[model samples]
Target: MASTHSTFKNALIAILATFPSILFYISFLHHHNNEDHSLWNWCNQHPFLLANVMFFLNVNVLFWFIALLQSSLHWMIGLYWMVIPVMLLHFYANHPMAQYNQLRSWIVTILTWIWSIRMLHSYLRRENWQLGVKQDWRYIDMSHQYGKNWWWISFFAIYISQQVLQMGICLPLHVVHSVDKPLNLLDFIATVICIAGVTIAFYADTQLRIFISKNQKLKQLGQPLVPILDKGLWCYSRHPNYFGEQMWWWGLALFGWNLGHSYIFIGAVLNSMCLGYVTMLVEENMVRENYRANAYNLYQKNTSMWIPWLIKSTSNDKGKKN
Candidate 1:
């Protein structure tokens, strides 16, 4: 049928569009590999590098296939989580002979895996996949906004572009894997910061989950609706979880910084910027639109957006002052 043909054509175009990003990622890997030894040149010297490249290609190809089959932007967005696992596999398979840094690499790899898995779990739960619910509100909005062109646009815009951004944001992992030095005091400090950030994020999410559950229960009981969370971590910052995420990335950057790789910090910087844009622009706007706009606006005015600091104008502070 003509419809089938059109679908096939669009799929082909999407696949073709991914090539430039693929080539760019390869070139980026080569450039970074050249910091010590050229990745492209060393591909001939070490067969493992070729295997690594192949693994990367296969994983992405699988992602593309899944995206096409599902036609769901949720899957496309979820592909970002794949970066952590792929990087971990690459680190383990291509581990250098330098035994000193092996422990450090293992630590970072494990932490990355943990963070990725936790985030994937959270996303799935929030989306409620078991009941066949799919796609978050943002993706739904995007679908409506883009109309029929959403399919191909999602391929090029969300899927491929996100992969590239994830690669860049994972620069710290690459740096950690490549560096030959042993874990030093700086690494220890960075590890502490990373642990702290993860802990904060975990607890922040837990608090939010509990709050939501309680609010839902109240609603079911026909009680008045509570539109916003203002206790626990939410009291200090409107986006405690986002702050924790930024802290975690910065901690990873600090690990690379300890290795004296200034460029690797770009990942943390980019991650922070992305979070800021999403939290301040996308998420806040959505909250105002969907929830109590005046209350959210007041919260935004009083609370730090991305840092856990006292909001002096909060009810508790006002009560104490009075």
Candidate 2:
């Protein structure tokens, strides 16, 4: 894990990660009509290559603007992700490669916009209106790991990596805008799933914020901090917010699947894998707390990590084992 963190901090090398993807995408875009290249002649091999390039290029354009906005993220931590749904809208309207399912694309865009608006509000409140001076704790931790070179390395680690994953997960939007098909009952199911995910996240974050505020008050008064949050959504899953986020991305994948681009699930799956990794880091941090460690360990034993579930007593498991 530490090595992975360092890998991202190697800005010169890490930035190369995106260079190839963008170049390949560009080569794919110009494969037929535009200029060609000898080395990139391989791009013309795939059929969806054109649409994929169109989507990728549009996303890159947005990322360029994100690049400027995120320039201060090392110190400011601004918003770049919420613009994804907007990119989908732009792509759907501008791409001339093929006629896609206009209705389906619009549906996906609207759902994403709702998610974006809610998340934007949540983030701004979390930010407390302070910009440039307040940096994200996660980025702070990483910057410490990278030491003085952090300023430069962060350009790739913080900005470039976010672009990669955000683009990956947003691939469902690309798929929806690239395919032409009739909507079905599955579309309704997908819509429900998407809404459910967003709802769960909204409530979970609300509960968590309340918990944090209460704990902060207790700390300020020289009282014991809450050892564990075992009420509401916290009773079922240790990280309902994470779970809901995965659900939201996976829900979007359903639309891609229904539209015959089932393979777009790769982006969602990879994003989940990364989230799972971060979940482990969070659990490790919880176990390190001297005051909360024991209670957190017990909670960890009974509570589901990603899936919400009823808390099963460990004594019952021990009895069954006997």
In model 1, what are the clashing residue pairs, if there are any? none
Q: What is the C-alpha lDDT of each candidate?
A: 0.64, 0.68
Q: Count clashing pairs, candidate 1.
A: 0
Give the runs in model 2 whose Cα sits over 4 Å from its true position: 1-72, 75-78, 314-322
Best by lDDT: 2
Writing each residue's lDDT as its tens digit, candidate 2 over 194-219 gives 99889988888889888888998999
Model 2 scores a TM of 0.74
Q: Model 1: per-residue lDDT, tens digit, 1-322?
A: 6555644554464355445545644564546446465554455344334434543464455555555676653443453463444544454335432233778877887777777776766655664433123455666778889998887676666655555566666667667765678778988888888887877888788888887888789889999666677788888888888888878888888887888888877867877877777775655564555545666767777778878987767364321210
Report the C-alpha displacement of residue 318, candidate 1, in angstroms. Answer: 12
TM-scores for the candidates: 0.75, 0.74
Top model by TM-score, which number?
Answer: 1
